[model samples]
Target: MLAKRIQPMVSQARRLYVELMFQVMGRALQAVSEVDDAVKKETQALPAGFLFEMMVMPNGPRLIVEHTGLGRLHYHGASAPRPVDLSIQFKHIAHAFLVLSFQEKTAVAFANDRMLVDGDISYAVRMTRVLNRLESFILPKLIAERAVKEYPSNLHLPHKLISAVRIYLKVATNFVETVRA
Candidate 1:
C-alpha cells in the first residue's frame, strides 16, 4: 500500500525534474551557440528552418532548438509551433537527467537503448556532434571528459576559459533581453 501511494508522487517529481532540465538546457545551448563560432559552423550544413528537440517520453518536458539560418541556432519556446524536423527522446526521466547532468555520456545512453531519435540518422549524428561541442564549452574539463567520447586535443585550458566567460555573458544578456521583451 505504501509503495503504491509513493509511486504517483515519485512520478510527478520526475516529470517536474524533466521539465526543468529542458528549460535549463535550452538556455545553455542558446548561450553556447551564440558565443562559439566553431559550434555555429557545425550547424551550417543543416537545413535552414529545421527544428530539433530533446524530450522525455509520455508528456514530460521538451526543448526545441531550431536552425534558423546557415549557421544560426535559436531556442524555440514551448508555446511555439510543433513542427519538429528531428527529435531525441529519452525513454524515461532518469535517463534524461543522467545525460543532462553529465552522469552518462549521450552516446552510451543511446547505445544502451535509453533514448529514441525521431529523424534522419545522419542529421542526428551531426546534432550529437554539436551537443558534444557545446558540452565541452560549458562543462568543466573533468566532467566534459566523462561526458564526451573523447575530449578534443586542440581544446586547451585558455580556450575553455574564454568560451566559458563568453557563454555566461551571452546567456545573461539574452536573459535580460527576454525579460525586457
Candidate 2:
C-alpha cells in the first residue's frame, strides 16, 4: 500500500522534470539558431514541420517540440494532437534525467540501451547534430566537451558565453510564459 502511494508522487515529479527539460531545450535550440549560422545551416535540411519528442516511459511525461524554418522552434503543448516524426523514449525516468542533466550523451545513452528511438534513423542523426550545436551554445565548455563527440577547436569562449546568456534568457522567458498559460 505504501509503495502504491509513493509511486504516483514519483511519477508526477518525473513528469514535471521531463517537461522542464523540453522547455529549456526548445528555447536553447531557438536561441542558438538565431546567433549561430552554422546551427541554422545544420537544421536547414530537416523536413519542414518536423515534430520531435523526448518521452519518459509508460506515460510518465512527454515533451514535443516542432522545428519551423528560420530558427523558430516552439514547444508543442502537452495537449497538442500532432504526430511526432521522431520520438526518443527513455526506458526509465532516471535515464531520461541523466541525459537531460548532461551526465549522459544522447548517443551514448542510446548505445547503452537506456532509450529507444521510434523514427527515421537519418532524421534522428540530423536532430542529434542540431542538439550538439545547441549544447555548444548553452552548456559550459567542460560539460559540452563531454556531452559532444567533438567540441570544435575554434569555438571561442567569449562568443559561447554571450550565446549562453541569450539562451538562458530565452529559456527563462519561455518558462514564465509556460507557467502563465
Candidate 3:
C-alpha cells in the first residue's frame, strides 16, 4: 500500500523536475546565444528560422528554440508557432530526468538508446554542441564535467564564474518576464 502511494508522488515529482529543467534550459540557451560569442557563432551557422525541439515521448514536457538569424536564438516555451526542423525525443520521462538532472551525459544517453532524433543528423550535431556549451555556462564545473562529453579545457575558473553569473541573470530575467506576460 505504501509503495503504491509513493509511486505516484515520485512520478509526479520527477515530471515536475524535468519540466522545470527544460524551461530553464530553454532560457539558458536563449541567453547563451545572446551573450556567448561561440554560441552566437554556432547559432549563426544554423539556417535562419530554424527550430529545434527536445521533449520526452508521449505528451511529456518539451522546449523549442529557434534561430532567428543575426546570430540570435528565441525560446518558444513548450510549443512553437512554426514547425520544428529538428526534434529529439526521449523514450521515457525517466530517461529525460536522468539527462536533465546531469546524471547521464547526452552522448552516453544516445549511445544507450534512451532518446531518438527525428531530423537532420548534422543539425542535431550542431545543436548538441550548442547545448554542451550552454550547459558549461549554467552548470557548475563538476556537474558540467559529468553532463557534457568533454568539459572545455580553455574555460578558466574566473571566466566560467563570470559567464555563469551572466547566463543565470538572463535566465532569471526571462522567467520573471514570462511570469508577467
Candidate 4:
C-alpha cells in the first residue's frame, strides 16, 4: 500500500529532475564556450575546442582538457552543450567543477593517478594553459548567496539540544584534523 502511494510521486520527481538537468547543462555549455573563445584570443597557444575527459572521484576531480582544433578545448566527460567539449560525470561532477576552489592540494593529488587518465595529455595541457589565461582577469562570479541566506531577524530557537551537540562534534572533528595536520 505504501509503495503504491509513493510510486507515482517518485516517477514525477525523476521526470522533473531530468528536465532541470537539461536546462542547467545547456546554460553551462554556453558559458564555457564563451569563456573559451575569449581566452583563445589572449593566449596564442590555447586550444581551439578540446575534447578532454575527467575522472572525478569523491577525493577530487582529475581534468583532461583537450583541443579539437585551434579554436576550442574539450574537457573529458559528457559532451558539453557545444561542438568541441569535455565530458563531465554528468550526474555528479558538473556541479562540483562549478563550485569547488582549485587551491586545495588534495584535489590535485587525486588527479595524479595515471589509471584515471584515459585520454590525451597534450589536450589537457592546452586547456590548462587556456584556463591560466582566463585566470589573469576575474571571470564573472556565480554566487549562491541567496540559497544560504539566513533571516537573522526571523531566527527560530533550537527545538533540541542534541542537534546543537551534533553540530559541535562535527566542528570539533574538523578542528582536530586541521591541528593534527
C-alpha RMSD by candidate, in order: 2.3, 2.9, 0.8, 17.7
Per-residue lDDT for 89-152 in model 4, tens only?
3233433333333322222423533223334545445434443333222222122222112212
**Best first by TM-score, ranked:** 3, 1, 2, 4
Better of 1 and 2 by lDDT: 1
Kindly list the per-residue Cα lDDT of model 2 for residues 37-123, writing each as its tens digit. Answer: 787787777777888887778785776767787655666755345778898789988888788878888879989999888999887
Off by over 4 Å in 3: none
| Stretch of 10 with least lDDT, candidate 1 | 74-83
Q: Candidate 2 regions off by >4 Å?
A: 1-15
lDDT comparing candidate 1 with the true structure: 0.82
Task: Write the residue-wise lDDT of candidate 3 on 19-122 in tens digits.
Answer: 99999999999999888999888789889999999999988999999999977999999998878999999999999999999999999999999999999998
**What digit string (tens of lDDT, one per residue) describes model 1 on residues 58-130?**
6678889888886778887554476799989899888987887788998999899999999998889988998
Candidate 4 Cα deviation (angstroms), residue 29: 8.4
Q: Number of clashes in every candidate structure?
A: 0, 0, 0, 26
What TM-score should be assigned to candidate 3? Answer: 0.98
Ranking by lDDT: 3, 1, 2, 4
Report the Cα lDDT for candidate 3.
Answer: 0.93
lDDT, candidates in the order shown? 0.82, 0.78, 0.93, 0.38
Best by TM-score: 3
